[model samples]
Target: MIIVYHNPRCRKSRETLDLVQQSGETFEIIEYLKTPLDTSGLKALLNKLKMEPAALVRTGEALWKEKYRGKDLTDGQILAAMEAHPILMERPVVVKGDRAILGRPPEKVLELL
Candidate 1:
């Protein structure tokens, strides 16, 4: 099954979800903000995404800027920040089988479908 880490507040995430629905493919939505991921879950997602903890971060968020900007963080620290602040996690990550993609333009999710 396809899994979409979605955020209703994000326009791109909504668009991605709409596309997934239109494709007539099976998918599950995980609202990361509402159902936050722990470090281990985040690690699993990172493995699927083939990304480092820093790569999964929404660096432009206020939380990152106000607290983590310019800090020399290890992977563990970065993951800790994301675990503590789900808002720092990027939206609309689509996972299928062993692969995952960030649905930035929304259409990227089509690759998994």
Candidate 2:
């Protein structure tokens, strides 16, 4: 099944959700901001995404800039920060089984379908 880590406030996240719906596939949406992911879950997602904890972070976000930017943070520290502040995590991270993708441009989710 396809699972989308969605943030309804994000334009790209909304666009990606629309694309998934148009694809006529069953999918699950995780509004991670409302229901946050634990450290292990986030780590597993990072593994599926083939990314480091920092890579899954939205560094451009105000929280990141204010709290984490230009800081020498380890992967564990970043993961902890993400767990504590879900907004630091990027939006529309789509996953299908063992694979996952960051749907930055939105259309990238089509790759999984």
Candidate 1 Cα deviation (angstroms), residue 5: 0.7
Going through the candidates in the order shown, the clash numbers are 0, 0
RMSD of each: 0.7, 0.7
* Global fold similarity of model 1 (TM-score): 0.97
Model 2, residue 6: distance off in Å is 0.4
lDDT of 1 by residue, 12-77 (tens): 999999988998988899999999999999999999989999999999999899999999999999
In order, the Cα lDDT scores of the candidates are 0.93, 0.94
**Candidate 2 lDDT by residue in tens digits, 7-88:** 9989999999999999998999999999999999999999999998988999999999998899999999999999999989
lDDT of 1 at 2: 85
Clashing pairs in 2: none
